[model samples]
Target: MIKIDDYAYTSGLKDVHPVEKVSFALIFLLFTIISKNIWVACFTFTVMSIGVLFKAKIPFIAYLKLLFVPFVFLMTSLVAILFSIAPIYQEDLEVLWMAEIGLWQIYISSYSIQQSYELATTILASVSCLYFLVLSTPLNQFIWVFKKVKLPAVFVELMGITYRFIFVLLEKMNEIYIAQSSRLGYQNYRSWFSSVAQLIVSLFVKSMSSAKELQIAIDSRGGDEHLYDVDLSMGYNRGHFVIIFFSFITLFMIYIMTKS
Candidate 1:
């Protein structure tokens, strides 16, 4: 099982109703995206982090590693927002630093710096909200929620199949990678590229074979058109709902108080 999925099944919040968890996550995600207040973004990020690490009982190191994955990508993209290139430097521009390269000038302005900071916080905050959901709720529960909402059976089935396929591909890829590494397939840069190409091709072929086997199994089971029949009924804790409601109200109050 994937680390995140394992965490979800064993999470402290696993017993909480899927509806409650989904609503809480979506609400926080929407608020983080729509609110322009930096304080609100910071608060959301901190609160969600606490929920995931403390309430959900996810490992602190694991959480940091997950966050770090996106942090690298975020920093890479933020570079574009943090700096600008122009044919000539403007004397009146509020630049913190500048470099002259040939006839072009690359500069970091105070405004751009502020924008980058805000954008980074907002994105991280939104990601935290999503991570809370993913870390606490299993994919099966998510499908249950979708079905409860009367989502199309085809869509729900596709989601389940696609999620399963991802794990399958990952497992196959890992096995192939380990086998190759044992034979010193990645001893050099050239071999590494060749090994990666071989791995991709092997994964595609293996995935197709797995899909065919799955179809055969499904056909043997009655050839049902709808594969997912979720009968899960998770009871909601009123206390949790009350707590979340009051917590969000507190956040809104804080945002209003700090809006100036």
Candidate 2:
């Protein structure tokens, strides 16, 4: 299983009702997205990080590694916003630092810095909120929640199947890579590229075969109609819901206070 999935299944909060986790994550995500003040974004980030690390019992290093993946993308986007390029400098531009390249100049300004900070904090806070939910709630629980919300069966089925396929493909790819490595397929750069190409082709063929086998297995058990009918009901805990409601109120109050 993927690290995230394993963590979710083993999470301290795994026994909590899935609806509570989902509502908490999505509500905080909306708050973080709509928040205008940096403080609000920072607050959301802190709260979600605490939930993931302490409440959910996820390892700090593992969470940081997961967080770093998005941080890299956030930095890439923020770089463009943090710096400006122009053919000629303008006196009113408030350039904090500048470098000349040919006839063009690239510079940073206080305004750009502030904008980048806000964007980065907002994005990070939103991601943290999602991490809290995914780290604490398993995929089957999410599927169970979806069914409870009366989502279309086909959509739910596809989501479950697609999630399973991701792991299947990963398993197949890992096996192929190990086999190739054992055969010295990556002994050199040229062979590395060739091995990767072969691995891709092999993975695709194996995945197709796995899908066919899965279909046969499904058919043998009747069909795909009631495939996901397993009981995942864990009765709701009103205390968790109450805590989330109060948390939202607190965050809303913080947002208002910060706005003024």
Candidate 3:
């Protein structure tokens, strides 16, 4: 039988300790906040790429494909904001110099460069780091780590429930959609809209019914009073520390190199 959560479904980042994974992600966020140098951003990307490669063992092609998701949003936003601003004061800006092309003449005001580079670098780094972090960490482990970090328990619990509920809702919705389509539900625009609305309403009702049944089942099985318990003795292994440490070291080196 084919497993639902197979290699395609799960990221290898789940192997690392949750706390370590989150820590590295936060550090990347911090770097983005403090730096705007293109070289620095490039360096950070290199480090993050390495982290995704070695830490998660994700294929290079997979990483590029995943990276494209954020790149589209980021580049679109960057170009939109940058082009919108008019050059109030024309000054020769030193953009990437092409060999034998002495200082390509481009007029940029003070505010534009400061705004564009800072926004561009921070957004790219943030998106890239977050994508890797999410791919590596399981939703449950991420929540558990957040709790360990002393984040608000209520918020975390709510987020956890919402995350799980989304997939459940999607599964149900997909099933309903397939059944409806098989019955020729989309005969026209009016029919399509009405059918979709009805389908959603049915899904909500079914979900509520499931929730009630689940509650009854839990009560029947002892109602959270030792219904089930797991004994976990998680250890901090060498590989975990090694990967996290190297990520930081590489990040720091990138910062240093870019500064020089």
Q: Count of backbone clashes for each model?
A: 0, 0, 0
Quote the positional error of residue 90 for candidate 2 in Å. 4.0
Badly placed stretches (over 4 Å) of model 1 are: 89-91, 219-224
Per-residue lDDT for 43-156 in model 2, tens only?
A: 889999999989999999999999999999999999999999987745678899999898888999999999999999999999999899889998888888889899999899
Show where candidate 3 strays beyond 4 Å.
Answer: 1-10, 59-62, 85-114, 187-191, 207-232, 238-253, 256-260
Model 3, C-alpha of 168: deviation from truth (Å): 0.6
CA error at residue 193 for candidate 3, angstroms = 3.4
What's model 3's TM-score? Answer: 0.69
Model 2 regions lying over 4 Å from their true place:
89-91, 218-224
Candidate ranking under TM-score, highest first, comes to 2, 1, 3
lDDT, candidates in the order shown: 0.89, 0.89, 0.66
All candidates: TM-score: 0.92, 0.93, 0.69
Q: Which candidate, 1 or 3, has the higher lDDT?
A: 1
Shift in Å, residue 27, candidate 3:
1.8
